[model samples]
Target chain A: MDVETLVLVHQLYGAQSHYIDEGRATEWAHTFTPDGEFHSPSYPAPVVGTAALAKFAEDFAAQPGVTRHVLTNLHVTPADDGLTARAYLQIVRTLPDSPPELLRLTTITDHLVRHAGTWRIRRRTVRRDDTKENR
Target chain B: MDVETLVLVHQLYGAQSHYIDEGRATEWAHTFTPDGEFHSPSYPAPVVGTAALAKFAEDFAAQPGVTRHVLTNLHVTPADDGLTARAYLQIVRTLPDSPPELLRLTTITDHLVRHAGTWRIRRRTVRRDDTKENR
Candidate 1:
């Protein structure tokens, strides 16, 4: 990856975390493509398209307490003749309280494509580290 | 990074995980440089040098139950004039037995250097997702 690509991917990763943590559901949904899909272990099926994706984000943000999503260990690689890229990311959720407990650890595999000169997630699958059902 | 470099880093990452998961302590330690250091939130200080690194690997292998360190979401960037690279990796530990439970989730930041034609980790610091002290 070139320095520019690396920086762009980093920025995208950071933006996703920031939007989600701040409960900006619309902004978070905008990070994905129009027909993007998000699959999590917590959900039986994936949330697809902008409308469903926005709804999912809104529901998550409505939960009790504040969450700080800490993302790290991002690996980005090109795929399918450079039109798309695959990235692996780690997410650590922190609950703000008296002690600030760590709530969850999840790994995300993102399939991103360049849409309108910017990279947007086409598909994102999340696997919880504490679960055995999803690898 | 070039395609060759990206592939090389991925191979190195895979090798380290495979060796450690299979209890190949010597091989796992060999993935590091002679003066490499491994630091984790679980330890008070960093484990330095090849001998110490080997010891630490052996100790981890002797733990109860089997552990599969699933590594993903790796982002590698050039550092120190391209002679070294900084990579971020996520590790999920899965235990074997009835139900096969998920053990832990940790993130690793590795500093790798090209030594004698191969990439080796010079320093690796681990941060647990469930921790508050080590940010």
Candidate 2:
């Protein structure tokens, strides 16, 4: 992936926090491709399709006034097929001015594909080696 | 961050899925530093410190026979402060040989600090603008 393409996708990823922080649920739903998928073991399988994705946002909006996503240790590998990435993510949910409580997460690993004219999550899998809890 | 560190960290991140999938709860607890933390808005705040974090793992182990984390679209900003990363993560859970289901996640944005000797979460946040539901 070109630096700019990577940069835009990266920016979209960062905006996840802003989406919840602002409670802009619809805007939050726009981050993925219409057919893009979302995965998290805490729940079930991948959420595919825009309609279901929108439902996901509505549910989150009902709780946690504001949520932020932090990622670090980003290592991207540009491959002939796609860009391979490895990152560590920490999620925090805040209520107005409260001290954010952390939601536990271990690591993020993936393969991204450039589809049509935009980059989409062709296939992604998040793996964790260890886990922790918050007080 | 050097390519090796990036690779190692990525490998660690990818292991998140394996940790849960294999039900190696303790191994899943080792991903962070003694003071490493995890963040997810879905929760209350950041899970700082190993002890509290370990509790987090135990809770997750109670369910979800196996969990996988998938990260995509990683862009790293090597700042003087540290390595800043942005990524999108998807998690899946499987029961024995059952089909994995998707969990809702938006994006991961973070700032990682290289601790005294190794890389730690430093600070992490997960953001979501959109969400999806699984059938």
Candidate 3:
């Protein structure tokens, strides 16, 4: 049971990272459920739906060159609500060919559910860590 | 098992938050092992031990006003290694009295282990989210 959840959660994170890295913004947005909340507080606004998510990622991907998100410290467990499991994430990103930029390192608190026999993020909130802006 | 791990992990996060809020830096630092790594990418230097962690929190708590950390979208799962589990965290902080500020929101990737019949953070890395300074 634990094995399955761990593998699934890690795979989901990996797949999402791939989507962002590959600029598959639409597919990346598909990772979440309808009406789900996607909150990256640093953003000018939160992206909530598939369309909004896609646009957010599209704009994000339009940044500079290639990007790599290095995610670590993944904690996962089944939620009390069946079919749902919550995860806490620590993630970092790097872009080569430049000053070795740090794109976004965030704590991704995620709500995932087993939809159609696979995991999907129902809600995702990327919180800002210290060392960020005043507000 | 899932219930136990979930409770434990959440407790860890909540407890750590309490420590930081209450200025119990030493006890909070004790939550990790001797060689544990506490990495918050935005900091000028990473806090890696009980002593360093204490100072880090001390300096942080030295800031005026009350701060509340809101962590959301938690994901959890067991790790490949026995007695260890990994977690991903998306966290937010709110400092009142000044335009509803947003402090360091980050994804905290953590390595936890069962030590002496309880769980502790073996390694923690708080990645920087976008909307931070040049790094």
lDDT (tens digit, per residue) of candidate 2 on B71-127: 654556576777766666665567897876655445666666776575556656775
lDDT leader: 1
lDDT of 1 by residue, A1-135 (tens): 565775677688779867877889998998898999998876889899989988888888887677676654455767773434333333333455554544555557778887878888998888654565433
2 against 3, candidate with superior TM-score? 3
lDDT of 3 at A69: 54
Give each model a TM-score.
Answer: 0.60, 0.45, 0.51
lDDT of 2: 0.60
Q: DockQ winner among the candidates?
A: 1
Q: Say which prediction, candidate 1 or candidate 2, comes out ahead on TM-score.
A: 1
Residue B39 shift from truth in candidate 1, angstroms: 9.1
> How would you encode candidate 3's per-residue C-alpha lDDT over B15-124 as one tens digit per residue?
77778777887877777876667877667777787788778778767877766555443446567653343332333335565554444344556777877676888888
How do the residues A48-107 of candidate 3 rate in per-residue lDDT, one tens digit apiece? Answer: 878888887788778754454545566776676533443334333434322233444567
DockQ of each: 0.14, 0.03, 0.03
Better of 1 and 3 by lDDT: 1
Model 1, B23-132: lDDT tens digits are 78888899899999998877888999988888888888776544446566777888884434434344444343232334556777788888889888988888776778
User: Which portions of model 3 show Cα errors greater than 4 Å?
Assistant: A1-135, B82-96, B131-135
Candidates ranked by TM-score: 1, 3, 2
